[model samples]
Target: MSRFFSSRYANAEPYKPGEQPKGQTVVLKLNTNENPFPPSPRAIAAAAEAAGRVNIYNDHMCRDLKAAASEYFGLPAENIMFGNGSDENLDFAIRAFADDGFPLIFPDITYSFYETLAGLHSLPQVVVPLAEDFSLRLEDYRGLKGMVLIANPNAPTGLARSRAEMEAFIAEDPERLVLVDEAYVDFGNESCVPLVSKYDNLIVTMTFSKSRSMAGARLGISFACKELIDDMEIIRNSGNPYNVNSMTSAMGAAILQDDEYTRKNCAEICRVRGWFSGELRALGFNVLDSRTNFVLARTDKIGGKELYEALKARGILIRHFNQERIKDYNRISIGTEEQMKLLLENIKEVLK
Candidate 1:
């Protein structure tokens, strides 16, 4: 460790992202939950146009992007906030809303980044366990008083609660701040974004990475009441007012305006998810009923790590966590039908 390193983060365990393998390393890359399709043509054009104007500083407020997002989300511009990605918005929320007195609370097994963010901010945290079937028990969060962050259509498990259920939970405590991470909402899960207008204490964040096919662009959108957004904006401005670059802002606005493209891609991914889950189940794997573009599955024939290793050896990639509870399961992101068929063929060969 460097002598100049801060002692505050000496014990911090940073979030580990999925491995990014070179194209030649794996024929099918399905570890990270990125959209398999290309982005809308309009978004690509907008980005190209913006790239020409990069000499000028980006709009600190991201006014044009926010206006497009506002129209798309049916909210006032003041109620929306943009960040480098949803992770930044989540970090900002933790900084702006949580503390020693006001701790952060979320499911013990979901997203995993919430814990990282809590650690990074040096904030107290309360971990609530999910139900046996991996469904979130909202009742467990009723008595806790703090900022709550939930990853809707939660990672790995892909299980999700409906918007009504979320609203009911939010109504249970008006004083508590609830942050909903809807990064995978477009893939057949209901979003809590609409509730932001009705609930002042609610914050909803979405990324253009998944459904919008702009993971490379690094744009994330957040919606809340004006006051809550103002709070997050304060935290945002304190760090980097022009967090989103000019090209990204332009691309994000164009994609939002091209809602049909996003919708079509999400619908196709949902279809692929359903078919892939059925195929996995047919092959003696226990696959979760997922609402997102990924599935968590395990088979009695092989250990999770063994399966992951075997697949990687055969030029395929999937995510396997070393965490105790879910160590035996693997997360596979949905790709195109042809890619999935190739994956299935490889899995069958590996099983044999």
Candidate 2:
């Protein structure tokens, strides 16, 4: 608390990201939902080649990258927007739509970043709670008075609602803006990108960080009607004309060109998620059905915090939220088969 600190930021509570331990120790990290595999070889080559052009500013509009995404997703470049990451895109949405009067609406136990963004912007927030099984109830969101942000295949829980359900929700309020954060959509979840052209009020944000294994590169894309995308572009250019660097832009374009690479990785992750979930259940843990590359589980024998600490002590790292309803649960990212086997062995030892 600095004596000269501004009162505007007095109540700001920043989101705490997962731990990133940097050392020589080999840690089986399942805390952050990062891809265990490396990025595509072509993407790596493109990035390496683009490194030489670092002295020049990246294309402000990210034209080539947008064109590549357009080709891949079958959406026009006019309907696409790019940012530093999906977090930035989400922040842009909050700034563009949410206000003190309009407020921001989201799931009560969804991505924590939504709350942080709302707080940063001083926007009123309406957090609608999910059903008992953590599924979104369409009726609960029938008449939201503000911008709605839904994380498809939501973080921590990793549960997803179907596209039909989402379409119905979007149809409920055509005037209200609905932002779908699909950061984990590649992992066995249906994407709302196809609906962007159909609904003028819908904006879907995705990231290359999760499935593309480019968390370090920090590339994010948003899909919507041209008018909405133009508004987001205004916000983006007003802040930073070159939000994405050349290397990232080039690499992201290359990666999008080779969709098979990410799809293969996503399939593998989903397979591992299923296997890991079953293994956790066999160990007396209650695992939630997940569509993302992570699984949310809780054990009747041990508390989440206790298990989290125990796993960390044994050179493994998993996510544990200290929130009220989910404090007992741990969110574990799906790693390779060998890594998962090691995790299961460690869990058996801990339980014993």
Worst 10 residues of 1 by lDDT: 19-28
lDDT of prediction 2: 0.89
Best by lDDT: 1
The TM-score that candidate 1 achieves is: 0.98
- All candidates: TM-score: 0.98, 0.97
Across 195-302, the per-residue lDDT of candidate 1 in tens digits comes to 888999899999999999999889999999999999999999999998999999999999999999989888899998899999999999999989999999999999
Q: Candidate 2: TM-score?
A: 0.97
Task: Candidate 2: list runs displaced more than 4 Å.
Answer: 22-26
* lDDT (10s digit) by residue, model 2, range 1-352: 8799887766578989999887736469998898999999999999999999888788888999988998999998899989899998997777877788888998888899999988877778898998888887768987678899899988878889899999988987887889999999998888999999899989999999999999999999999999988888888878988989999999999999888998898899888888888989988899999989889999889999999999998879999999988999999989998999999999999999
Residue pairs in clash, model 2: none
Candidate that scores best on TM-score = 1
- In angstroms, give how far residue 73 of model 1 lies from its true place: 0.8
